[model samples]
Target: MLKLFYTPHTSALATRIVLEEVGAKYEITLIDFEKNEQCSPEYLKINPRGRVPSLVTDSGVLTETPALLVYLAQLFPQSRLAPIDDPYLFAEVQSFNSFICSNLHVAHSHRMRGHRWADEPAAIEAMKRKVPQTVKVAFEQVERHLLRGPWVLGEQYTVSDAYLFTMAQWMEADGVDPSSFPKVLDHRNRMSLRPAVRSALRQELGDQ
Candidate 1:
């Protein structure tokens, strides 16, 4: 069985979402950030960076949500989470993947640790102002792509949409307007309505 170490409301949510979509049997090991379990030596050995997401599979240990998603998609091509045997589709998957990673994910990381970015009060102040702008731009780009339909890639609910939906959860706290991006709002709603997403959310939360 595959074992995934993760915390809720983190990028690890993306991995959980994908695993649910693929119908892959796996065990989730919760890592409590509040308890500092992620920083422990055992967890550190799996991921030296102390990240919340680390997948231990029969093949090997996989870290990083995007890498794991792509890996799993390829491993189970019939799931249609990602493209296989087609260079163009692979390029598109990677292209959109980078957009989310660099823009949305990185900006969220900054917001999660803005104070640590600088010792002085002034640097923290600057980060607080800039991070929102960065996130907004990324959100706008996502809105543009999602305008096509209920999915980022148009008609296919792939890993790209999963990533977008997971990160868009921050909109409420970050003050990013999903209303302005109507398509994105709809897309998020559509994703939320999926049985797989609901099941995964419940399982991860242990809400029997």
Candidate 2:
């Protein structure tokens, strides 16, 4: 069995979605990042970077949202989370994964984690203010590359769809205009309807 160390409303939700999509059962341990529990000695032992979405497998611990998604995609090939048969399409999937993580995720991180980059309060505030513009720029690229579909990859659903959906869910909170990209909006709505995605959301949001 896998043990997932996660925090709600983080990129970790993507991992949970992938796991659920594959019907994998795992123990979920919530690391209250809001309260700085990730910094605790125990969690730091699990993940030196003190990040959420650490997967403790029989082998060892795994971190990084994109890495975890890729791992699970291979582990459960029947889920068809990725394109292992087509090299070009697989390359495309990897490209999009990096784009979402490097551009989209990094842009939004400035809003909440400015302290990681700068010490001065002014610098932190500047980063926070830059989030909207940065997110807008990144999302615009996502909007442009989004295939004509309810999914990022068009006809087939991939792990990248869940990844993008996780980032898209933060558009409104980051002050990015979600309406500008109607296709992406439709993609998000479609993702919201998936049972796996719904399961992840329920765990992350704690439904009443």
Candidate 3:
């Protein structure tokens, strides 16, 4: 059995969605940010980075959304969540996920987590103010070139889709109108219709 540590409304939701997509027998542990439970000594032992979406496997532990999503897809290849058989296509999946993590996710984080990059109040505020434009530019690239239609990587609905859907959920909060990017917005809508995605959202957001 796999155990996933996560917080709602975070990128952790992507990991949870993948877990459901793979139909894995897993349990989830919530790390409440409000209570500072993520910084607790007990949680620190599980994930020293003090972040959400830490997966405890029989072999060991895995952190980072891209890694976790790929791990789950590879663990259950029958689910076809990734192109595990084709090395080139698999790398494409990885590349898409990397961009989301390194670019989009980081841009979104600046809205509230500017302290991660700056100490001066002015610098932090500057980053916060720039989030809308930066995020819009990042998604423009995704919508125009990276997104590849019906799903993130073409006809297949891979882990990349789940990752993108997770970040797209933050568009409004980042002050970027999601409707501006038709392809990305449509992809997000399709993702929301997936049973796995629906289950994950229900688990995290409840009846709201």
* lDDT for each candidate structure: 0.81, 0.89, 0.93
lDDT of 2 by residue, 77-193 (tens): 999999978999888888898999888899999999998999999999999999999999998888886555757788889999989999999999999888988888989998999
Q: Top model by TM-score, which number? A: 3
Q: Of 1 and 2, which scores higher on TM-score?
A: 2
> In candidate 3, what are the lDDT values of residues 1-208, reduced to their tens digit?
9999988889999998998998899998888888999999999999999998899999999999999999989999999999999999999999999999999999999998898899999999999999999999999999999999899889998999999999999999999999999999999999999999999999887612
Give one digit per residue, the lDDT tens place, for model 1 in 84-143.
677897778778878888778888777666755677877777776677787888888877
> Using TM-score as the measure, what is the rank order of every candidate, best first?
3, 2, 1
lDDT of 2: 0.89
**Cα RMSD for candidates in order:** 1.9, 1.4, 1.2
Better of 1 and 2 by lDDT: 2
Worst 10 contiguous positions by lDDT, candidate 2 = 144-153
Q: Whose lDDT is greatest here?
A: 3
Against the hidden reference, what TM-scores do the models get? 0.92, 0.96, 0.97
Mind sharing the TM-score for model 3?
0.97
